[model samples]
Every structure is written in structure tokens, then in C-alpha cells.
Target: MNFKSIITSFSFTIVFAIYTINSQNTIGETEVFTTTNQAVGNITFTDTGDLVYSHHPFFSPENRVMIMDAKTKTSKPFPNKAWNTPRTTDDNYLSNVLGIRNDENGIVWMLDMAQRDHVTPKIVGWNTKTNQLERIYYLPKSVVPKHAQPNDMVVDTKNGYFIIADEGIGNGGDGTNAAFIIVDMKTGKTRRLLEGTRTTLPENTPTVINGKHLAVNGTDLLVGNDGITADANFEYIYYGPLNGTKIYRIKTLDLVNEDFTVTELDGKIETYSEKPNNGGMSIDIAGNIYLTALETNSVAVVLAKDKSVKTMVKDANMVWPDGVSYNHVDGYMYVSAAQVNKGAVFNDGKDLSTKPFYIFRFKPITKGVSFR
Candidate 1:
């Protein structure tokens, strides 16, 4: 059989296997939170247990950020409508937001790509305690290239820093350029590292979603330097490319040190075990990295001690699991399934995404890191 036929058959078999597995397992029950026809780009739980998620700008236009009531399954614009409203010349407006996380200090940090109208990228912090904007740090053009797509972020509140992944393929172009961005929380200083390096850039491999090659407009959708997370002690940052398998990490001190040369920094990078095509990632207090395995529709756990991978959960409804966040209060890892492979971006401009995108959560064996 040809590759296409093999993929089709594999997709069917995987779906059937997931159903069979879910029917047999009772320990991890996946609870789905409906998004009212909006694609959930990323999700984070507030200190009070409310769900705050971003409506992926790739497909939707209203409410770039929202807070959802778990009981009512309803959502409203977070903070206010002014920040989310799209404006051509307003510097304070939120153009596009993807990665978001709630810190222990009652602050929610959001990474705005600022792709719309070619505005500079920025990081916005909202203090949930005060229900107001805490701070906004605009990134310099040197750190965020014109075509850079800042995908995900992890905040180090204790050390006052943020690490972000730039997929580098903005507006649907070829995926070759990519980088790791480090932002100093105190000074608002931003620096780009590993730009276009083999560790940051995607391999010459096609992204297979649901066992089929994800191609749009006669080009395969290859993303780079996407999933990122920080250790519990805030000493190291872990990251991997979306289209690549190997995971890598670097010391936080080396990243922030001005004396470290690029060659020296490159030497400090430690390669971990290979992983499946993954989306968002988070590390627990025990140092285990949780990843959303997009191809197999499961959550994979990578142990810090041995760097070995194991599947935490697999379900039939996990269509293109996009982001994974650990909520300590609930003791579960929340995952957002945007059904990105089924959206218009991959379906030749025909939207195949089902309405009411889902956010699923399941309890992991290990307790999550208490960064907040």
C-alpha cells in the first residue's frame, strides 16, 4: 500500500484502539468543557478554579481572551472588552493571544503574538486579585522578528523571567526560522537564542495529524520550537520543536548570563529523550514533563530522572489536543483540543472543525508543580 493508504488505515485503527482503551480504563475520566463554537487555543485555571482560555485567532474574531464558568459552561470576555477589541493603531489593544498561565501570586501572564496589523509582540499580565491589568511589556523588533509567531510561554515568577517559543512561521509560510525568547520580567529586556539552529528549527519532516500528513495549499504544515516548560525550582527551561522528536534543556543561569557566548550557550544545551509530535507541555513538582501527544490523541509523560516517556491518557474525543496545563487545586491536567488539523487552515479553506471545541482534563499520577 502507498503512504496515504497506510495513514488512512492507521488512523482508523488508532481511533478504534482509543475507544477500546477508554471503555476499559476507569481511573482517568476525561471531562469535556464546551467552548460554544470557539476553538480553545490554550487554557489556564484561576486560583478560584475558574477556566480562562483564549479563542484561537486563526479561526475566530470575538473575545480573544475569556473566562468560563465550569458549572454553567458559559464564557465571558476576561477583564474587559477593551483589551480584546481589535484596533488598527491602538498600542494597548490585544491583537492575538495564545499561551497563558496563572502564577501563584494571582497574576495571569499572556503572550500576545501581535501579528495583526504587524504590531510588535508583547507580554500582558493581569492581576486576578485586583481584576485589573498589572503590567505590559512590549518586545523589541530584534527579539521578535516580523514573521515570528510566539507560540507558548512559561513564567518564572520567583526569578522574574519568562521563556517563550517562537514558531517563526507567521501568516502561513514555510517553517524554517525559529527561536527561543527569554524576557526579563523586571527590566522588560528580551533576547532571542538558538535562532535557526537545528535545535530550534523543525526537521525536514511532514507533520502527521491523526495519522495523516497535514498539508494545506500544497504545503505540509511544519511548526518549530513550540512546546516549552520550566522546572519546579526554576533552574532550567525545557523545550522541543513541534515537528521534531528530541527534547532539549538549558540552565537558566547560562541563558541570562551576558558573558556566555552563543557557542558556549550551544554547548550547554542538554538533549533529552525523543518525544512524539506534541503540543503544549508542563512540568510537575516531581520534574515529570506532561505533553499532549497530538498524533495518538493522548497525553504523554516524560520522567525527569530517566527521560522516559509513557502515555497518561488516550480518548476518542482528543481531536488535535493543542495545550496542556496542570491545575493544582483540581489535581488534574487540563487539555484543550482545538481540532486544528480539521480546521480551515488544513482543509483547503473548508472548515471541518466541529462546533463547541472541547477542553478535557484528567488526573495525572504525579501532583503538579505549585508555581503559583
Candidate 2:
């Protein structure tokens, strides 16, 4: 497996320091930036659009969650004990922020699924500005049925609740129970919604990689879509099961009201799609949906009102986009190439992603609402 044979679509344009690397038999290059290296996990933006994110460090006792200037492109880990409990469910550092978002009040929140085997797996949050930890936003292990894991989340700041999607299968794609949980920011209570919808789904759509269906985990990786955000209007919540083709939504009021059944909530699914994607999902202030789809080898966008889809930028730079952010100050859109599914766990010991998982910001789509 080499570059020329496996990779068919690649970007010829080079605007920044770029290099070519092998990503699963395909040759790809990315916009290079200087930031502390730890496998970058998930990224979000402050109301001003400054870059804030977490990374998976190899040598540190704990992972780093830091802030950066998206423009100058610099980053530093947050002050220790300043961000919040770096611990997990059973009592360990809460590492890996799969999702991050800032609310209207300017609170930066994350749905952190800490590594429990290293400690206990759990979800918790911290206010970015105050650096205060809210330890109670997570669901009790007793509340989860069995072998259930909480992955990513979407905050409903107005209604005071955040919706979490369960991929069931963790990074290993095994033993995770699928379901969604709603956290009532007011009461600090959590409720479960559709968890496995994103996990149990079969790989109905295949990504073109070297003209072969890309496979991760010995089985073509599918199901358990991750990434979510509330509509800018705060009227509806938009989300996707990481691998599922459709983007779904439901009224914020309905999500927090446990009285409504998941089946009833299913009626609101909007099925937004440009193509099948298996990466982080987010929306901008104008309500545009962004997807880092490997299938298209591009970062994609969907208009909220009409469900119109467009490939924002598709060259070599867009490989395996994971998390996306909006820079309000600079007026640009950003995305990452986690090539998450390309890890050996998913790709049968073969890493299918191009080296240097990236972070990129295109000009800007300044028209509508952003769902992030």
C-alpha cells in the first residue's frame, strides 16, 4: 500500500507549510502549524473564536487541555488545578474531550469521557474563564444500564441541558453500551436518550480509499455517530451518529423532558447529509452543519434552512476531518483530520490515515446561523 495507488483525490494548492505523508496507503499532505504535540483530541472556539482544545499526550501523567491563537497558531496547556478535575468516573484524570463548545454566557463546556481502566470512566465539565469545576454534571454509573459509555455532547444553554450521544463502541469499538444522555444544567441531573443509534448502524455507505471499502476493526467500521451542537436559535438540537449518514434534530424542550419517549423524539430527525462521514460534527453561528467526511475526502457543510450541502474545501488538506470550529474574530471555519477510524484498532493494525492529523481554517461562510 503506497500513496499514488491508494489516494486518487488530493489538493494541489499549498497555502501554508505543507508536507506529504502516508495515510493508509494514500499520499496526503496537510497545513503544518506549531503546537504542543499530543494526539490532538477535540477542539472548540471561544465566543471570540480563539482555539481551545485537549490533546492525548504520551509521556505526561495527564493529557493537556489548552488554549491557542488560531491565527498566530500557538498553544499552551491550561494551568493545572485551574481547569477543573482532571479525573474520571471512578477517580482518575478526565482525559480526552471528544467535544467542546462555548455557551451564550461565555462558558466553555466539554463532555469528557475519562479513561476509567486507568481510573473510572465518567463525564465532567469546567468553566474556561473561572477555571471552576462542576463535578456533578455526569450520570451515575448506576443510572447507566451496563457496559455503557458516554462519548460526546451538545449543550442547550438556554434550556440549561446538554445532549450526549453514546457511540457504545469506544475507541476500541467494543463493549460500549449505546444511548444518549441529557444533562439538566439547572438541576445537574442527567437523562438517557438514543445512544446506540449512532453505534448499531451498519456501514451502509463505503468510503473510496484506493477504490476499496475502507475497513477499521477487521469489520468495516460503522455506527455510533459522534459530534453535536444546538441550533443558534436555541430552538432545536442538531446531531449525528458518527458513522450514520443523517444529521438529526429535536426540540430542546423535548430532549430534557424525559416524559417524551425516544421513539417520539425520533420523529424530529432531519437526516442532513452531503455524504457519509465518520468524524466530529459541529455547527456555526449561521446554522451551517460541518462534517469531516472521509468518503468525500473533504470537509462538508449543510445549510440549515434548505438542507443544501456543499464541500467547503476538498484538496489534500481535508483528509479525515474530525472536529470543526468557527473563529468569530477572524471570520473563518476550522477543521481537524483525526483520521480517528484509521487507527490500528479500527484498521486491523494498519493505520489508514495520512500523517500529521491536521487543523485548518478556510476563508469563511458568513451568511446564516452556526450550530456550534
Best by TM-score: 1
The local distance difference test score of each candidate is 0.80, 0.57
- Model 2 stretches astray by more than 4 angstroms: 1-36, 47-49, 56-64, 70-72, 79-92, 116-120, 134-136, 142-149, 171-177, 197-203, 206-208, 212-217, 268-274, 347-355, 367-371
The C-alpha local distance difference test score for the whole of candidate 2 amounts to 0.57
lDDT tens digits, residues 1-372, model 1?
A: 999999977885675455436634422456764545788888887887788888887876678889887678777888679888877667787788888888998888888898864677898889999998899989888988766889998788867788889988887645577888889988888888888887888876677865679887877878899998888888888888888888888887877677888888889999977888888888778787888888877778886668878777777778888888887777878898878888787887898888767788876545787542
Between which residue pairs do clashes occur in model 1?
Answer: 104-372
Superposition error at 232 for model 1 (Å) = 1.0
Q: Residue 180, candidate 2: how far off, in angstroms?
A: 1.4
Cα lDDT tens digits for candidate 2, 61-96: 254567787666676654344343543344534454
